[model samples]
Target: MAPLRSRRRRALAVPVGLALTASLGFLPGSATAAAPQTADAPASAAEAGPELSYVVNTETGAGTVGKVKKAIAKAGGTVVTAHDRIGVIVVHSANPDFARTMRTAEGVQSAGATRTAPLKAAGTTEVGKPEKVREPRSAAALAAARASGQEPLESLQWDIAAIRADKAAEVNPGSRKVTVAVIDTGVDDTHPDLAPNFSAKQSANCVGGLADTGKGAWRPYTEDDYHGTHVAGEIAAARNNVGVAGVAPGVKVSSIKVSEAETSLFYAEAVVCAFMFAADQGIEVTNNSYYIDPWMFNCKDDPDQGAIVEAVSRAAKFAGRKGAIHVASAGNSSFDLAAKSLTDTSSPNDTTPVERTVDPSKCLDIPTQLPGVVTVSATGPKALKSYYSNYGLNQIDVAGPGGDKYQVPEAPAKDGRILSTMPGGDYAYLQGTSMAGPHVAGVAALIKSKRPDASPQEIQWLLKAHADNPGCPTEPYDPDGDGKVNAECTGTQHINSFYGFGIVDALDAVEK
Candidate 1:
């Protein structure tokens, strides 16, 4: 296993009060009363104005949330909802001039229309009937059969197939079932490939209002937001014909809608609630793909923020002790988590003051950064760092095929495609550390299925021990100045910020 490196000197501060609110409006009897009755119609009906979402940019400063709310009211607009973590406000207005006005509002950085539509309800549909497996197949035979196209599978990646085959050989196909909780925008419980694997009777929607209502329920949840479906497919989509195979095909999935959209803050309360529900149902693994920037947490010292972090940490730890594993995306910021600077050469072109260093003391991604959770980074087929993934000698625990944009000379076209389930009865091509997280989570499930006696820590150790080392011939200079890349480390012989323990090798992990 990769040695646990030095503590990151520049871990970012955790934010506070960025949690999502359960109710849309202030309580009727609350001291802070709702706005007085107005002649204007509701904001949703207002003429099509530019849709808007806010992003918080400062850790120590206040956001324009209140101002945005007030402006929405003054402009005859209604706030569909507000997310404190990312400091986003989803509002609708009839006036096309609203965006211009909002741009000038106090505390407002910027506002614009969301790329996706509002959430919708996905109806229940039977993609295929569940079948009982009488026996498990040998790993070698399964791999040979899949290679010969004898099984109905979706992923073209040989590694994924090999991993699944190994998992199938180790356990009783029916006795060892894994339950993966998906915490994202929302999932379409009705999609054919996904439907057979869902534990709907055991699932719940925590996005507010009646269960399964709001934009959260829409079919092909991908139309509005595909994050949840994509993650779910990676963990447990059925192996039957029609789509790609999940890492743990025999595992069951539970949908937990924590974020309404990608930028929205998934409330700490919602997360706790989801974990509690999963615990109650005996779910074995929980996968989180969304993250709020550091500034939204208001720094880790705030009482409220600290409490939320502690609660999440405790819950995840509890799940681990109970035999479940928690996995999360390390984030897409491309920052050197220990040095706290933009690690990606491409980051300069994406943000202001291109060369400005990212402060490590104020920038870690939640849940992933929290203790006890297994954080994962992204890698391509060639096993190189993905340009968009965040990395740190100690922050990231493992890497997986999250899909890199650059082409690989040996396997150019094979470099970046990840085949996973999508909404609307189709498959999709997604690329992110988000895609990488589930791959590890699914492997954890496979380990658990084979060795139900293995503890969470033991499973984590097993994964680390089997990781593929992507040896960098020479360590790059610590450009961001977090201290020279630990001189004690040689090439990729040991851990480095750019690539954690190395690329995930399913065949190696299962064999161990």
Candidate 2:
């Protein structure tokens, strides 16, 4: 799927612009002057209301957090949340001068007015097939299959019979109930195969001012992106004939639309609201397939940028704390996340070379980059890295089958081979890291269903420990270095960047 761009029109201010410049290693004092704030004079203190957050300098060390908090309190601003890593202080105040006052305060770095609102429901986008209701496959057939005790299937493509056979021995298919939230465009609650698994409550579109589809109020009425529907099917398509089965056949799915064919800003409020809804609905697992690229250079870690991350992180943490697991796509952009410099770091002697820096005007990658969220990368059925799938050893937790037909070095014969659900019909072949994310998500739901007591971290560790390492070279494509692959470029016994922990092993995860 093509990436959605940001639609925010307002230009950033001085501190923010300066921060972006500094992040790119540009001289701090060399930044261009920012445009005037607003034409109208500052609103009265009462009209301005209280400030909600204070943006801080990324250069400020950790020690500055307490000092900044003290200052906020002295200003009668109640600190609601503090993001130390990104230097942001979420507060409750309507003060219009909050940004100006905090910018001048010692250790304050920068301050800006922040807004927080309740996440609203999203409207239905595309309407596909209705949900499906099915009778349990023969218990006798399942018993006999288990009695044979044959080895589990090994093909990368999803096999329903195989999953059922393997899980039948230990899992009571009826007893394992899991709710997976598809936080993407939307789902076709009417799809025959998906109907049985969808929540009776119609899905919600969080986009504001959108038409109210029967699914939810205020959801935008738009063309079916088919993104979320495909994802939903991959996680819980019923075991009926006419299509492939999901990793977890019996799990339930809840659709939450947070994106459109338009822009990311159109869905920003929707995204935040989706997270809040997921937490309140007791939905255990959420699959986020969308993301915003990093903003301006130094602005990668700017408070505004970090605010979204922190908010998402808090929501994920809340879900985790509530026994839910959040899974997101690592992204399709291939870059060494650890090696990329978002800010200028002063070497011991301030002599280290500074190369390309990320743009801070862009919003940092979402859901995947958010803390406490399990970021997943894509791998072909052959266990090779999908050319389009992004990789960051530290960021991506695992890999799964996301058919990659559009990468460099002509896509292999199996290029367009992702096993997922398609609208208007049952399961079909599709490809992308978007396809890969749900495979892991379905497996996660299965794990949670089978081991209800396991913590989110424990489940993550279990999945990682059981992954099958796809031995891809460690030295990323060296365009200029000697063509030969070096020894250090080889795979080790454990985790590596190309394939974090390795391709997810369903059998091992379920058994472990």
Candidate 3:
């Protein structure tokens, strides 16, 4: 199965060294729950099963939430925390039937296990297999690039140049008032390119469903956890003439580390916390690069999946309601997310995955597929859709320079992937819609800086309005140049499957 885009990339290389990369407690009626026993109950409440996390959705009311909490306690679950604003309570349960029992309770809109795996255990994905540089730049070429009157490595950042971000910077380098939170693995804020504009106050470690704002709380916890750092650099790596420049170098960026340390799995609870934190922190935008874990597509027909959806959806909407625009990657699977049916074999990804054919209408990729979130596709240096970017008409809101393996960029960049800040104050080249999302997030930050009073919905519309749609190709898209057509394009030039409203125009975002 295609690995999710959180770190999706084929082996690529750069001249630089291959440096690839909470908690709430609800203290409620401790001893007793008034609810009755459940049929699907485990052998004994004393002998708890594998500990699991679940989300219990309910209507917003003190009486309703109180009764639901009582029911949860009775079902052998502990309230991890509750988002009173969204009426979503996070629960940890060792009882195998806890979700089943909670669903039968009054005032519970939905309930389900948040993951297939027990707490703390998660499946791992390799960062990427490093290979020889595809287009190695000569020493003279490197020197010439460094001579450019921008960040030392700015000349290597073709992705920035592709969207005219280099030009955009001179006009309005963005605003310190605007902050885009990287809601992914974690970001290395110490990187010289990112530190100057990093906003520690807005950053946190949201793993395990709680926000930890301790010093260095929001940093990559493991060696391979470099995705968020790369993403943050793409958005606002500071124009300090050190490393590569970001799309909106003047903007402030905060890291919201949500993915688990060992497994890199992005659980629903952590995702919800990140969104809620972003909303409460007054973040102008957030970049979500992965599908919620366990299920690539959360099918509402299923009880547990439905609860995960409701809980996360509520959090995302709450962020929007509070004026935070969320920009999410369209995924790296290359599946047409708007199609009738799609295959998801790597779902329940924290455990053994079961292959299933799912309808796009029902099963949704969280955050990205949610309403009011700007869904982004990726493009190559040539402005063609990246080979691995997921796309669809109406489903995608914009496209960005995500890099393409088949469409190699020129020297200095020296690879078909993107270059951004990595952990350890270094930089590396990687690619995915994961990379694309941040570019758009940077543009959205620029928009937020320009139109500070605009709402999330308005900024989203403006993103499309300023996008430069390449128009649907008359012929089938074959970016890889194989005999077979890779993916078909749909919709009109103004709005299509391949390029969305077209590549996001950062220059116009500031100039317009």
lDDT of 3 by residue, 1-512 (tens): 12342323211111134332101111111112323347344326565567888899998988889989888887778899988778999999877667777777898888888887788774111123322122334576566655765676666678998999999998999999999998977888888988999999999999989999999999988646777777888899887756688999999999998888677778899999999999999999998877788777888887778888999999999988999999988877778988999887776667766778888999998878998889888888878888777888889989998877677777755566677787777677766787788899999999999999999999999999999999877777888777789898988878899888889999999999
As for model 1, its CA RMSD to the true structure in angstroms is 13.2
**Best-matching candidate per TM-score:** 3
Measured on C-alpha atoms, candidate 1 has an lDDT of 0.52
Candidate 3 has which clashing residue pairs, if any?
A: 21-224, 22-210, 23-210, 294-348
Best by lDDT: 3
Which consecutive 10 residues in model 1 have the weakest lDDT in total? 1-10
Superior by lDDT: candidate 1 or candidate 3? 3
Compute each candidate's TM-score over C-alphas.
0.62, 0.64, 0.90
Quote the positional error of residue 118 for candidate 2 in Å: 20
Comparison by lDDT, 2 against 3, better one: 3
TM-score winner between candidates 1 and 3: 3
Give the count of colliding residue pairs in each prediction: 19, 38, 4
Better of 1 and 2 by TM-score: 2
lDDT of 1 at 476: 51
lDDT of 2: 0.51
Cα displacement (Å) at residue 456, model 1: 1.7
